[model samples]
Target: MTLRYHAHKPLRHHPGMPETRLAALLSDVIRRQRQLHELNQRRLAELAGVSQATVARIERGDRSPSLPALERLLAAMDLQLTIGVEELDAHLDARLTEQAARPLAEVLDGLGLDRIVDRLGDLPYLLTGSTAALLQGAPLPTDAVEIAVRWRDSARLTEWLNAAYAQRWNARWGEYGGVHIEPEEPGEHRWLTRHGELRAQMCDELPAGIKVRHGDRSYRVVPLVQVEATDPRAADLLRRHRQRQQAAEAPAG
Candidate 1:
């Protein structure tokens, strides 16, 4: 089945979007609307002043309707075709949550991480642990944020981070005199503001969905699916973590 995100209302299609992508998004919305209303192709065609074949083609991904045609089609389903900027991040977060409960493999497939990485410029950095989990609105056991780095590239990565997060770096190394960075202003560092308590690690294999960007931050998050699949201990850890969070958030009895 095609990946689908259910919307409480129809998605707004903005102008200047490529025709093919727009058509695909619109078709999904229309298909969902028709299913919600329990209307047959013939009924929708009659309501939209279109032929059944046309509606069939649109729903089947074989054709894209002109603007006027789309308007009429949406009107039939009590939806309006409008132009507006969509909150893409919020939409993506919703889609992530929608698939969170599925099998790890299924969640990975739906995320299309391979496809998403193609568009990102920076590479070779990983955002792991509870930080990634929280970004996607999933419950986590802890909030300690960690960025994984290749042991061979630790020095280079540290230099890059110091440059990127200038003025925040402590300019002093941890007692180990290694890759550890002592935040100058531990409680109010820029990295801390975006990713709580940033620390670096040298590792061989990073988790899935680990890239180099999370929202406005530079470190990318590993998808929870990957975390669960690659780390045998993750499931039990996450369960306990979530329970702790729920307990903390629960109202006084």
Candidate 2:
């Protein structure tokens, strides 16, 4: 399911951006965005609409990319960076929350469905950008669930996309904001996010939403123990979950 972040309202920018500072920030942002997208030097270079060597140059802050050019790169990777602002932290979680309140599939399916990655499968996904947000429970724009997967053979992506998991998706209909129905289609896998740059990992177990039904008509989710939290994608959620736990343990203030 896709989650909306309190960013990009009218896509405004913060003021007082010196050319030098803007260049530095853009360089850092490009580097981070590429890393989060988990694009390797070559792959990220292609997707960012820049050359691989240029990507390296940009990342090192040696080159100052134009704002429009940078915007294209960011949009391609599904990252919305905030800059030159008096209130960098100011955001409207309310809009995102409202958007998230709607059923994911309902809106996502209508928003031009794209290739989805099923982490439960045998493929390898390059973790980055919005995919990173989903894994970490960081706020994100309401979009389809996305992860870059490494198909053994590029052709294998299509095979997997059409192939359904033996098990049914036992999720509560509309429970999750967006859906990543497994057994993806490879032909549709047009873009491969650079893998491992962000150091994204597999979940030690299944996610909470994953479930199954027994012959006896009983239902179950992928158990917490079976759920692998090692996936860096869940970093934000894990941190938030930890904070909530800590708050609960704190003495009454």
Candidate 3:
């Protein structure tokens, strides 16, 4: 009863989408689960240990699920939501191609100093560590893939990122490596709007000697060249995503 596209569906999809849009996709799945379960807000509220208002908000796609809240609701239905690497990449591709694609400059005129991720068609190596913080939405986009962009995509990009923060998707710079970034706080929206168009740089491909600094620490956006050597599945997943992204690329922008 999850959100799924039937085989005969006509909608076309792109490869990996930006991180923010994926939150909407996930929220849609939860809403569908509620519908298929034939459970109303009141019923879900009782079974999931949430109030009617809470259930209503989640189903309306106005809110994202916290881990514990998701657990409680899943438990209520004897179901669990599992996100594998495949599903994650698939969702990313769909999102990237959904909205109109802007040029690199239009995507980055306002964000901070940064570089584009190479390997265009599919972004296989997600900057899954401290590297993510160097970007706008992913001050820590690890475990989440990073899409290298130019100044062109900045406004829409930031708008998209602000949406992610609103949903509590973690994008903050984590204290240390291996510590996942999570937007678990209430004021995360404030954190997102704080960057009032920081200047950044971007080349069509990865460049050497590019650098970015936040506080006393510096981060870089180097190609994830080694991931392909180690994980073959990662390569395949990204290839599929790239195909989808290119296909979804709108002609206007």
Candidate 4:
């Protein structure tokens, strides 16, 4: 998924720190580390001497832990918290610019999209998210392809992926090797393979899509309007691109 950034605003007490982003980053780190260590909230809380509710709240990003609490939690997992500073958004902006300059077809080819589609054969799928936007000529940078498939079709798709691409279902952070496709919550399942990462949005039924041809292959893609409505990243990119176009055509105002 694309990372969203707000306008540069430093925390008053923390100087360069973006409070919201840092809280999210910290929560993600704590949750992933706990999962990697094979400890649930209760287990981690026991080791860290914190209440299970506290662990849950921190992992949910609803609360920021004090330094003592944070260190204790990290220590239980054999980790140490470290702070570093760099130019915010510099790397991500540069990467996005580089991707934006490349043709969408080239990006798809690099990600082995054609091989994937050919292998899927008759399985129904509609490209979604930024991938769909790119397919619909939105000029968005798509790192990975996302597809929406019916819930009933997920098992067959998983079987095909395993047989064809040796795909492994990503169960948790640094965890894999599930033969079945099970989503913990609605609308999210990811599989990893040598080809690349394939993210599937499980749905009761496939959304309506428009057919578009890319490099001699016709693909069903979620319409630009649908993508804009559903995907925040794609929506933001399209919004900014339209703003730029409007500014350029403003007759030198």
Candidate 5:
């Protein structure tokens, strides 16, 4: 059986989660718990007083069980569902807010931007995203050094990363060493290294950047307008920062 919810209403009234994702999470949790308990579908169904077909459907994400059904399934495996509230992206948001208040030069120093720039050595990169925003005089908080490099040059960049003992960041597995990095997939590719986190946006051709001077050094960074237009996260943070500044400056009512 398939389960559906109103498109306008998010699952459990959470701001970011959708019904489909919640269903998938439930499916994964149920399947993994059953496996951990060494119970097959038929055995689990017997313990939970549910049909084997119901177990199969739930595990396959073909059905969404009601609260009682879900609780029974979990109880059969000696597991229980617990819910807790968390601030989404709390760590990142806090970091951004903190960095937004500091000097851009200090932020760059903390990121070890010079080390990455020097390591990249003639690889032809332009600062992008929050890094670019900061270079363009917008105090955006960024945890990683973001750069755009040509697709053709990815191989060379990968070599540098590998030599520096960097590991590719995987969503499910965290970081692992010695994986080939390429622009085969679209969007940002990230790596964790001793120096810091590095994020690269591979492009067919390098984006236009303007020279900016900071702390007696010049760097090429994507223009603020382009960054605001293209990078939504950076743009949103910048927008919020500006709003806070405006509120602070406003006279009391």
Candidate 6:
């Protein structure tokens, strides 16, 4: 005798998440469905009447599918999207707010730059690039903490950072419009330690008075004006950072 099995209940999600995060979660759902059904992009596209490229893009996180497109795609797999309002966990919500409202100095100290600055001494340094943009109330994507010092301090700063991080320092000349000082860590045990190099500028003109005063300690940060006047790429970074903050501030659907 032939038997038919009932399908599992669909997964449900609560609302109030950022749109980008929600899109990412939905993308994962579609990808998992495709994998379980052993279907490729072309097949999914055929079933959903969407282009193969559209299916590929959605699955790869390159593009967010429209609601109609997503509904059709999910319907092909006998699934549907549900949106509901649910109360956020009080403790988690409070923690996120505290982190977002934390002062730049506290953030730097948490990232261990406070210790680095203390060891490196007051060499007329200012944190630069995206990190600076972030400190200036911009939500920027900063891969590493970039810093700048006077042209004369490059060699000394290199030595200081190498000793401080317990890694070999190598200066890649003529990179990022100046010498890029990267720390060469030993072995493959590198984790949680911001895996990008600190930018060291050997420029004559470095901004002043951009320090974050935290009680007795003062941490240097590059001025947004300086970042705007510097390289075109750096200026573009500031623009993108501002755009991200604007998008984040947008109302949730």
Q: What are the lDDT scores of the predictions, listed in order?
A: 0.53, 0.42, 0.41, 0.68, 0.72, 0.57
After aligning candidate 5 to the native by TM-score, how far in Å is the CA of 157 from where it should be? 1.5
Candidates 2 and 4 compared: the better one by lDDT is 4
- Displacement of the residue 95 alpha carbon in candidate 2, Å: 7.7
**How well does candidate 2 score on lDDT at residue 114?**
26
Candidate 3 per-residue lDDT over residues 191-252, each given as its tens digit: 22232211122224333323445445444544334333333544444455456557769576
Native-to-model Cα distance after best TM-score fit, residue 219 in candidate 3, in Å = 57
Q: Which ten residues in a row have the lowest lDDT in candidate 2?
A: 192-201
lDDT tens digits, residues 61-175, model 5? 6656777898788777666665433465443445556676787778898888988888888888899999888887767777689998888888888778877788775333212
lDDT per residue, candidate 2, 26-55, as tens digits?
Answer: 665665456556665567657767766666
Candidate 4, residues 1-253, lDDT tens digits: the string is 2222221221122336566666666676777677558787788999999997888767766656787888888888877665544676443444455666887778888767877777778899888987887777666665456888887886777677667555444323223343444443332376655566677777898889999998778988888888788778778777866665577689964
- Angstrom error of the Cα, residue 52, model 6: value is 35
When sorted by lDDT, best at the front, the candidate numbers are 5, 4, 6, 1, 2, 3
Q: Between candidates 1 and 4, name the one with more favorable lDDT.
A: 4
Global Cα lDDT for candidate 4: 0.68
Candidate 1 — which residues are off by over 4 angstroms?
1-7, 14-16, 86-90, 93-253
Worst 10 residues of 6 by lDDT: 170-179
Tens-place lDDT digits, model 6, residues 1-253: 2212123323334457666655665666787677568676678889999997787667656556787898788877776765444554332333334545767666655556555555667666778776676666654443346676775765666566556553322112101212233423222211122333444545677777476555676557878888788746568756655565677899998
Listed per candidate, the RMSD to the true structure in angstroms reads: 18.7, 12.7, 14.8, 7.8, 10.0, 13.5
* Candidate maximizing lDDT: 5
* Candidate 4, backbone clash total: 0
Instruction: Please list the residue runs of candidate 3 whose C-alpha ends up more than 4 Å from where it truly belongs after superposition.
Output: 1-20, 86-89, 92-253
Would you give me the overall lDDT of model 3? 0.41
Off by over 4 Å in 5: 1-96, 176-178, 185-188
* The 10-residue segment with the lowest total lDDT in model 5: 4-13
Query: Which ten-residue region of model 3 has the weakest summed lDDT?
Result: 171-180
